[model samples]
Target chain A: MKKHETAGPTLLRQLTYRLAVFTLIFAILDVGLVVWTYTSQPEALGEQLLTLEASKLERSPFLSPDELTGPPGARSWSARAVYPARANPDHPNRSGSLMDWTRRERLEHSIRISGVRRIERGGSPEWVWMELEADSIRPYIPVILNELLTHVALPLVPLLALMLIFNVLAARRILQPLRQAEREIERLDAEKMTTRLTEPSAPREVNALVRAVNRALQRLDDTMVRLRSFTSNAAHELRTPLSIIQLSLERLPESDHRTELQLDVSQLNRLVGQMLDLTRADTMEFDTGTILDLADIGRDIVSDMTPMAYSANRELHFDDFGSAMVSGHAEAIYRIYRNLVDNAFLHAPGESPIEVSAGPGPQISVRDYGPGICEADLSNIFEPLWRKDRRRNDGAGLGLSIVKRLAEAHHGTVSVQNMNGSGALFTVHFQEGMPESGDLKQTLPS
Target chain B: MRLLLIEDSKRLASLIRDGLQDQGFAVDWCETLNEVKLLRQLVQYDLLLLDLGLPDGDGLSLVRSMRRREDTTPILIITAHGELDDRVVGLDAGADDYLCKPFQLPELVSRCRALLRRPGASLSTVLSAGNVLFDSSTRALLVSGNLVDATAREINLLEHLLRRTGQVVPRPVLENSLYSMENAVTPNALEASVSRLRKRLKMAAANVQIRTVHGVGYVLFEPK
Candidate 1:
């Protein structure tokens, strides 16, 4: 049987994916802020330098020659003298003999200079040139970007890794009750209708599901109990009359009519017995701890059925391989083989030897050299109340169905196929497992 | 032999009573466990034929209580519930044997006889299988209501096999039962005795068969 899959979206996968996306968004936002702060620093610095110089010029008016000889060749800013008439046409204040110029010559030398001119007031309005070299600050944006990546984004890698590890553990812990519930549900069989799922210690949704399942199980159990009791009572009621009739018949003197009556009673009794067996096959639990040798069970069944076979002028040949151990209920296994043999005896022609065999695969097979089951009826043979030729009133057509159900109850399977040219072969294969010897009940008590 | 039959169905109980009466048993029929409990305290029954679904109460409870009070009467559960679980429960609750409803009269009588013949039972000495009966006290061998002549040694062999009907009795056990410990048994003495007894049973048309397992021993049971 295929195991049930936990389909649909899992909580763990959803949590991990959302968390990873949030982390990525935060990292991008942090990188954007760092780049914006570094790139804008140079422009703000240029504006601050112009304001300081303009304030200085307003305060001293360049008439104080000492101010004209102020600090020169500064690391980021420099000042030089220029005549007012030599100002470029692009200058905004051409009439006042003052202008700001961006020098192209400095760009080739890997330096960008921005000059702001202030005309000297004392002598013929000579311009004092103040220039700031942008490249001389050495690409601070790249350095700042590198620092942000190493100090901020790099640490998040390990954090995300830790989160993933913790998420896996949490997911497994959260799913523990669900996994347990799955196992419990899988183990539930018709025989165990009374068993309920241990109310899962899970989330609200899962708990609700568990409760619903438990309620369904409760209803099912109640129905089964009612049905079983009714069946039991009905069987008793039916058998009571039969029992009375059979007892009355037994008291009568031997006669042809009495013998015929006995046969009819026995046939009815067999039908009732098979009907009960069919019910039992559906509900019976196979005790796996009781392991028995298939060969031994076969031998016992054959021995028990020997007289019947002999009366019908048929032979039962059992090819025993000593111990073909299988884990199952002895009664159920015995019934399975008994039904097969009985079916063979009824359908198969009289006088043909029925061959029974067992092997190490833990498989027992019964073969008969009778007219093979029609190809169309082979599949439906195991269906309850189905028969190849309904004219044969010997059975209620429940034997094969019971055999199938009993085999499945023991975790085994039964199959039937036509043999070459003639007859049919029925085989039952038990699942393999070797429990402790003492754990298994003996097929035949010594 | 006296039996207390507790069955809810009046007709079924009556039928079973008549059958038991025909088998030379004194049967007292009741419809419920309450009546059985009352009647049981007044008179000790040799056996209790119980039906599970009684009118007043479950017969199993009565069986359980009887066992608790140390009542050793054999209980044969005759119930409509023929399920394996029901049978197991009845047996586990101290029932001597279990028979499903609608069982054959002969099978029921035979089961009753087997229970009565248990080693510790009061009716242990009377050996019976099918229509055959061998009473040790009377030293009589009867088949189908007819007295059959058999040697004492043959009777001994039949008694030994009958004691463990439907089960394999080892050769040594049969040999020992056939002769006293002081008597030296010949190599094929047991076999010869078994052969002679088998022939006599066949001649009398006894509804039983003796099967010899080559290396094991012998088993005797009524063939269906």
Candidate 2:
């Protein structure tokens, strides 16, 4: 896990998702409110003007059309007259929307009065529009605004702007603690789990969650200590007893039964050792393996097992393509090599030759001129405790499994395939970033 | 050598005690930390073999307390795990060595001998791994009977590598041995010495590779 690089969802996606939702709703309300105010403005003004004109006519008893002739049809304000049997016949009839169209009835109505008028003789009206022109009414031009910045839009745009800004602040405040916790968690590698996350300055609810996580870490630490203790004791307990057993067997007279018992005891000891390995594997996460020269690993294991190979009358040879390095846990990697080599000796017939080789871009391929593994068994060979040979119950099937697991842990891979002619080839390849695969290879025996 | 063995199981304890005694060790057996603690107050042993699960206490804590008290008796941890999470913690807490379970009796005996013999101040001593030889005190390196002049840093790195002969020594750790805070050494300087050291080492054989594990560390490889 790269500590500094963000791994999953980028922050940009989250921002875009939130901003998009906010914008859609903001735009809808902005357009809706503006249209409602524009349409209703004429009605609100018409009522005031109609009341004033009616009062004027009542006072004069016969007011002339000149009295109603103010500029009206061109601006946010417009005016139309409705005289019962006296006002123009083409004027609106008050059957549909008060101001339906730009200047005519989009509905069935004709006369529609609109007045941005003061009850006084001379004053500016605010806003109005008419569906029809009238004889006693007029259109006057006044201040107009950008369709986007109208009287109806004045508050809505700023309101939308305020919403965007406030939500941004609110989102950041809410996510800040979570982001900090994420960084702290990311930093908690196997090497640094001993450190605790700094308690977040968050709301009461999130603070409780942080405390819970800290408690979990404390529990993990305690459990690891106990596990280590058990591991330490288990090793101590097994080694001493095995030593004693081996010593006791040594005291016994040389006979067929004694030999059988010795073999049995040794097998039991090996089994116990493998079990201990299983437990120890847990603590090995931080164990970045030793940088291994593949040639060295192959040469040592082959030579160590060479005596066994020769006693079986088998020829064991190794070739190298110069120096190749791999990352591996020294002890575990040794066991892997030892196990593979030993397994080869077990399978290869007497007088059969075994070849081992390693080189740069480190790969170890060990071929044994034995009956190759059956094609059907290739996939299952690495399964723990899965033995391909049913006839030979000489051992547990953990050898290849251990090799596979150890190889993967080291950021390498192991595979078994039948050769073109005879024998099975076991290959393990080490990828880059293996415990330490960096410097140029230097060939040296010591 | 006189030694203390702390374990919990009586049956296993008796068996181990009898076996170790026959191996020429003067063994004082205790089943609990209390007994070990009391025994320590009364007499000093050359080494302590402590099982972490002594009935009365945490074994590491006991070792830690012993260290605090300035008791310099070498301690060996007998663990069931072949792998330890932190060697530094054990090393820091005063344990001189660690051994995993189901080990060969001969191996244990040899490790004990190795630990006991480690503190001698003899410059004439030569550590022989196969045909290769390295003298710790004099910083003299020998490959097949030839004396070689390796720089101090090279010798230190070589000695450290030789200490774990047939095993991998992580390059960073070797680097640290060559240039830890105690020795104001830099990586480039270590690299220069390693390059020089490699040249001297390669004179022995061909197809012998000291491989670089990309992005991790380096290990000294000796093919038998």
Q: Please report, in order, the local distance difference test score of every candidate based on alpha carbons.
A: 0.75, 0.62
lDDT string for model 2 (A1-446, tens) is 45465477655556656766876687678667655664467543344344444345345534443454433552232344333323335656622223222323223323444332222223411212222343322331121233335453576657656766677678778878877777677766442246677787777666777778888888887887687667656655676677557656655778999888777777776666655555454344535445767777666666455534534656567677765776655566666676677678778777877777776567777788888999788889888778877777656776777777666666568988888888888988776644333443321111
* Best DockQ among the predictions, by candidate number: 1
- Model 1 over residues A233-261: C-alpha lDDT tens digits? 56556787887788778879999999999
What is the CA-based DockQ of model 2? Answer: 0.13
Provide backbone clash counts, one per model: 1, 25
Error of 2 at A264 (Å): 2.2
Please give the distance, in angstroms, between residue A332's alpha carbon in candidate 1 and its true position after superposition. Answer: 4.9
Error of 2 at B54 (Å): 14
DockQ, Cα level, model 1:
0.28
- Inter-residue clash pairs, candidate 1: A236-B80
lDDT of 1: 0.75
Q: Give the TM-score of candidate 2.
A: 0.50
